[model samples]
Target: MSVRRWWWVAALGLAVTGCRTTGSAARDGQGTPPKQELQFDPVTVTADLELDKLNDEELFAGGTSAFAANDFKQAARYFGRLADFHPDSRHRRAALYNAGLSHQRLKEWEEAEHRFSELADPEKGQGDALDAAFRVAESRYHLERYDEAVKLLGTIAAREDLPVNRRLEAQVQQGVCQLEAGRGEEAEKTLRKSLATYEALADKDEVDDYFPAQAHFFVGEIYRLHYEGVKLDPAKGSDKLAEDLNYKAELLLSAQGHYLRSIRVGNGYWATAAGAQIGALYENLYEHMVNSPAPAELNAEEAQVYRQELRKKIRVLITKSINIYERTLETAERIGSQSAFVDRTRASLEKMKALLLADAEGEPAPDPAAADGEPHS
Candidate 1:
């Protein structure tokens, strides 16, 4: 079944109470979580209204109106007031959630963190409260506080009482945070488990697949980074270089396995991401193999022949990369994918073709092959 992709890409908009609703039960976590992106011009506040003059109802009504209109700026104001001054109001909880969500939409991480923290109270840590915690963790993630995000998301994921989807969201995010924090071993375990759980779900179409796609991609990223880090040096002697090449190939294949799985997950964004990565694997392999220092014992004549022959061999790598890039570009276009990975894929395809052309035209370029390190997103 066709599924929604990212959280922001998830079409489930916030309700008047700021909770997401779905056809499934709330316990499924399908109806839990907030969203992002600003499609409408935000409503700006021209003047500060006296809080005493307007009742809690008025504040909530205005907030809901503004929120529905995607005027998150005003929504934050109204909801923030409803949460702060009218603490006794029944709308207080939703107010806090919406206020944080509004601030989050506006990219006010501190404000969003503050508001969500109020609703994330452990005493009331159920339903909306859990959602609030999730948002707080996301705010931390945006803030690059990966450790804090990981801790909070771990807590959220451990709650067996909440909806599985919400827990899944937390779990997936925790793995991503782990990845960002440079916890490769921990990130791999967390992300692999996330993929397993995602696959075990009975109703896969009912929730966003972004997390699973992320799991696959980040797991691939872990090994891809490893591949990039693993260096080969002919200066270390042919035997040691042979061992290094074998180890590097293992890392490369490991990375490739996960990238292929990411593509198989079939999310357009991640597929392009994986596709770009697959191309990168070959491109980088070319870079690794070609850039190694020539053995010191070689005569100038032998070194020239070595360079020419090695160039001939690694041209296949460039060809493989170009093919992968071309195919990825086709997929990106067909899926209407708009991601940095797609942009990178386009850029890489051009570079690979140019490098190949340079080889054909015998034009001077970087030694052997060039591989630009792919971004982590």
Candidate 2:
């Protein structure tokens, strides 16, 4: 559920950059077109001609220029004009695609979906229709229309004509869509199948493994979140608590297996994410045990004994978590990577070190009310 809430933050946690083709007139959509001025329709067009005065080709060129300059708002408007107002223009398909991509860059999901859906329409689509269809799924995912995204992704994944990587991406996105839809079990099965497909691919090494890496990391999250749901009842005493903890541990190790799989691929971002989550698993366990309700059967003197002894046993969790955070941070540095996960690992590492130091110094637990920013009573 935690993953579902923010999984769309980076296109399944990928700060991925894709290719952009500006137009025939411009240099690869980089800076301003140095040589190509807008050749307006046989009139004395001024240097700063308005959008209304520009011809369709000129609009296309302007959109490309705007897109290259990271002015996606202008790019969307110009490209939308080329696609909508100039139906007869030769650059119509390119214009629509550019418009959709521009909208996506701006996080305008509905507008992006509309543009892509038009190009992906059976009657309207051309050679790039498959790509447009994929973008439509992405737009739908961003819009939180997980069911629609899953359906569209299924169709994309089933296509034999597309590249293996494209199909794999579709399948992976489909699984994630299912997860976002609150279908965890189905999502895990779909993700496992996707991983199997990736493993079976002969050209797997030649292509990007981002999707598969995500598959591993998300499966780990699935288990981790499930583990978070396991509750303890102190009334059940130590033996029953041990059983509950065992189940929780099994879920964590299951998650840990997937996290290990994610790191094994060496895709820098996903690996960092998995590593951070792995540390959090132990940290969470420590917190959970320490914060559980005290056993009702214990006398006041016995309760103090229980708390101290419990802290002594669970202290290893902090140590283990600290080790993982340190290692993960080192791995992120070695890979020359930066992400929220790396920041989290660094912070968690510091926090755990503080906890370990506090315990070592025999500092009393801070009062609960004073945990707020107010001075202790």
Candidate 3:
């Protein structure tokens, strides 16, 4: 469930950078010729070595070195020089891609997108344009251009020669873009296919096998949104209540099932999130029950019996909810998750505890939000 928001950070864990100190600029007779103000975006490259001695390959090496060191501005400058000045250089296409990557690392999405667009062009781009297409989609996704992201991802997914892993990643990203764009049914269809591909993989334990859990989590979110739209009215007779409750139960259970599947497939942050959400799901149902009015047709005795039954159900539901919250806490702790989510789960657990105690004491629980000084949802 570690959904990748962008490809910029993807290389951070895979490659460790070496230390490289920025060299002090040497003063010249004209004082560095009064820094040139260029018409295009600024791309300044500096080095301790003589500029004249550095060839395109050396410039590219400097860019990649700076990239490894996380100096995105410096990296972009070096790569940009190769892309802008060395048009005939064999490294031009790669330089463009690296420039895009450097800008991406700096969170300069527009600049990154521009560079990536050049690489995405079949006629002009060289070497692995398909991968460049994926990066272009990633840039668009981060910029909240969900429609563009989906279209680009579709192109990558449709390629016959693309690796299955890359294709699946593209499909998953396409589904994510759909979901973000509020196209739930389309998201579900695409994500379901991605999930099936993950499940069908011969090596389920592959390091890159992340889409299955993410797909499950997103599908559960779709169900959760739909469930929130359902309203149950207690003014309706018990028969009506029974029918409506059954329907609500189906929606909630569907969400719960997918959440559990996410947890089962991957015991990562997404699983913890799904676990926390399951607790919230049950608590929401309990709240609905507590807030509901008695049926108008019930006799006094029948109303009393119904009230008792309601209280029992509420307590049972909340208790189940509390247990799931506790499970989330335990899982987070077990995984040494120091994420803010772990703190939120802890706060939610405390709130659930108060809720359970409130029912036992026959008094309203202190506002769970007040107890934690943090909003639950």
Candidate 4:
């Protein structure tokens, strides 16, 4: 069935089922039973009245059920109806929030953006409004509207009214958007700010340790990407490019450190992700060492020293990659209990080991095929 049609059917079902009303059986009184009456607590009576009068609770419940059923459009409609019918109901704000989520699930980007935008306005809904604004930015980000996402996230990051953790998340997401937009320098700056923010929070013990680990991982990814960019560009071979190469190396090493830190403090999904990133970084570094050009201005002794340093770095990275893969394999085995991913990890580790052995046995040199008469310039 078409998703839209299925959604409508689900909505009709929920609407019918949720509003079914029940009543107590009538009492059969003989002659004068002393006029006994049932009494309800004030709070309970008020709650029941609110439930019956507003119907907001039922609406939200129906929306949640529809969402669980993967009927996102129905969920949106249910929540949207609550927001429309009970504009002043206490649950109006929550209804709007869930409506936005439903739109997100349905991939209705513009509708999600609109719902989030409405909730984000402080004058419109003061309590959870800031959180809604952040979600708005996040929605824009997933839509690949980088510039708009960056602007919205930057505003949220700058707001003193927002919680520190949310500010940090905003900053990290902003950095990610910047990186995606190919503004590496700006991305580096934003990521550094995020890391510093997390570090400060860590020092105070005010932030969850997970936030710091996430910041570290994100910063590491930024650095790793920067390193890969230089490695991929053939034009970056000038003497002036030496600084870029050194910077790349420094960043990769820094990223390796952070990834390792994340692995140490992380578990479950974060641990797996950090381990994979660490292994990938090491693999990339190893590839760079394998492909690096020989120094153009090195004497015999200097050349020997350079080659030795390069080999040492390569060795370290290979060992690191192996260890990361081992950790990933163990984690996957624990989680999935002999899944296909675990088997793939094992196979990859075996291949990496063979490659490491071959690299160790062979002498390092520029590929003969790359020795064509033409210069890179």
Candidate 5:
């Protein structure tokens, strides 16, 4: 699906409640146990009345109205008051959830965290409490407290009472937090676990492949970062240089594998991104191989052979990169995707072609058949 359509679906899904069932469930957790409801935007307040006279429900309605109108500050005020003043009211839990959501929309990270923390209380409602905790963890993530976010998500994911989907989400989110915290290795492990779980869920028809698609995309990102970190030395001796190049090749191929899996999962947006990244991976490889200096100790014949091999390698890399970009562009067009990623990929394809042509037009290497009686492949 196009991203715009996906976003629209998300917005509509958030505007309604009672579409899913949630009930009191106890688990071996310190606080409220997780529920199976798909609570996205919580319940919105829709009361449009004087604050002094408004009852709890009315106050909640007012908050909902404010939120729907994009007046997040007013929405937060109404929901916060309903949650605090009418603590025992039936609407209190929803009010608190909405308030936290409103505060998040306003970028009031601290207030959002506080509101979500309140609903996470086991003394209140355990049904949606896990959802609240999830929101709290997300708020911490927005605040750049990645360690705290990871910790909270981990706690949520550990609860047996939580639905499998929620647990998987928490696991993925925890990985994201770890990645943001510069814990790449930990993130990779976490994400890979989530990926496996997602595949299991997909196989059971418990969840869509979209979740695994997301996991694969993030895994690709982790490896892409690893590939980018591989440094090549132009001045190093041939042996060391070859070792580094081999290591770089391994990283690049690993990244390629992850990206290919992401694309194969068939999530339009992520697939598009992964396809584009595949192009970029090969482009980087080509540049690295091309710019790396040959060892100075080699005789003229050896140097010619080395240059010929390098050119052959560059041709393969650039051609593959261009092909991937073309595939990405076609996929985007096929999906009616309207993302900047598609535009960038198209531009990259043109640039890659130009680079390939430039390499092809460069000074010719000696024919191996003429020089050494060996046929060129």
Candidate 6:
């Protein structure tokens, strides 16, 4: 069978034996509703293929045991059977939850998405629905359905019922999705909001120290990615886009500052990663600035001023990039030697510096006497 078809068949099998098999019966209406009670049947499907003596708790325990043993496929099977056969059992919802988690562990993305999506349906199982929603969004993200993931995460972000950390995580994921979808402006905005929220929560001692830095790192990545994309684009006409590009560049600068601050406050992989990203952004901006054409409207004085400012920015960025490269190289050397990737990056940085230096020398000066003799406007 085709991959998609096989995926669907597996998903169908899981659904038939999982949450989708639950009965649609409502309790009878009375003056007062009947006291809710969990129901279970004792019939175990054993290795001999005989349903002999299994209780709901036993079945659930078996599934949990399988999960703990890293037999996610077996765990899913057991959990699916329980969910399918014991619809009214208290373990039914939990069974479905376990099934979803197991599928996720198995990397059965479509199957996991189906189960999580079902659990997240408001009209269906209300047990940990918010968690399910988040997982569904995560699954979609992994599947590269970035727009769908963003939409789902956006909803989660807007909900007040979610915990601060969960809400912040959703917001960050939404920003990630937006970035993947090429909505850089939206991603930057969302990531900024997430970072601010994380910071506020951290200040109140509501969250761990790591979350805030993670938020900042993601925000930094958004700006860095945005700058890279704009710098790569060949078209140059709109003042608005140029302004946006400049704004993104400034954001990267600010992000680099934040990354350094994070390192000062707390040492972690995030700070190191952020430092590398900042270096890459600087290289990208340096290359763009070096290649940028001179504006037509500038007089000699205006041109000189513009060139001076540009040179200052480029020089600062180039120096920063070189510093970061040295640090990365040291880390790589300690880690057992540089990879081809790092070698290529180092070469690129060197080329970028050469270009920047060439650009910094400015245009060749016409002979002052000849120009003065001939030029009177």
Global lDDT scores for all candidate models: 0.75, 0.77, 0.74, 0.65, 0.74, 0.63
Local accuracy of candidate 2 as per-residue lDDT tens digits, 1-377:
21111101001112323333334554556775555444323333223224657788888777777777777776766777677667899887778777777778788898888888877832223356876787898899888999998988888777777667877888888999999999999899999998998888777875487988999998988998899899877889877887998899899888888998998887889989998998899889988987897778778999899888788657767777877788899999998989999998999999998988888788554433332221111
**TM-score, model 2 to reference:** 0.79
Candidate 3 residues 1-377, lDDT tens each?
11112122111112223333443555579666443332444344433333336778887777777777777766766677677667899977778777777678787888888887876842233344765777788889889999988987877777667567777878888999999999999999999998888878888765254667778888998999888888888778888987888888789989988988888876577878888888889889988889998888999999999998888777777777777888888888888766676677788778878878877799454344333321122
Better of 2 and 4 by lDDT: 2
Candidate 4 runs further than 4 Å off: 1-58, 84-90, 122-126, 201-204, 232-248, 264-268, 288-319, 331-377
Q: Which candidate number maximizes TM-score?
A: 2
Off by over 4 Å in 6: 1-55, 121-127, 200-202, 230-255, 261-269, 279-377
lDDT of 4 at 295: 61
lDDT of 6 at 80: 68
Ranking by TM-score: 2, 1, 5, 3, 4, 6
Per-residue CA lDDT of model 5 for 211-300, tens digit only, reads: 677778888889889888888885777788788888888887787788788887788998898888888888888888888777877778
| Candidate with maximal lDDT | 2
Q: Model 5: runs farther than 4 Å from truth?
A: 1-58, 84-89, 121-127, 199-202, 290-312, 336-340, 357-377
Off by over 4 Å in 1: 1-53, 61-71, 121-124, 200-207, 363-377
**Full-model lDDT, candidate 3:** 0.74
Q: After superposition, how far is residue 369 of candidate 4 from its true place, in Å?
A: 34
Query: Tens-digit lDDT track for model 4 on 1-377?
Result: 31221221112222211222334444457543343445543331111222234376787777667877887776766677677667787867677777776677677777777877876852223355876777687788788888888887787778777668766777877887887777878887897887777666635455555655666677677767766777533344446446766777687777777776666655355556666776776677688766776666667897678788778667666766777688787887676545444555677678778887787678663343432222111
By the TM-score metric, which is better: model 1 or model 2?
Answer: 2
- Residue clash pairs of candidate 2: none
In order of appearance, the predictions have TM-scores of: 0.75, 0.79, 0.70, 0.62, 0.71, 0.56
Question: Residue 260's C-alpha lDDT in candidate 1?
Answer: 77
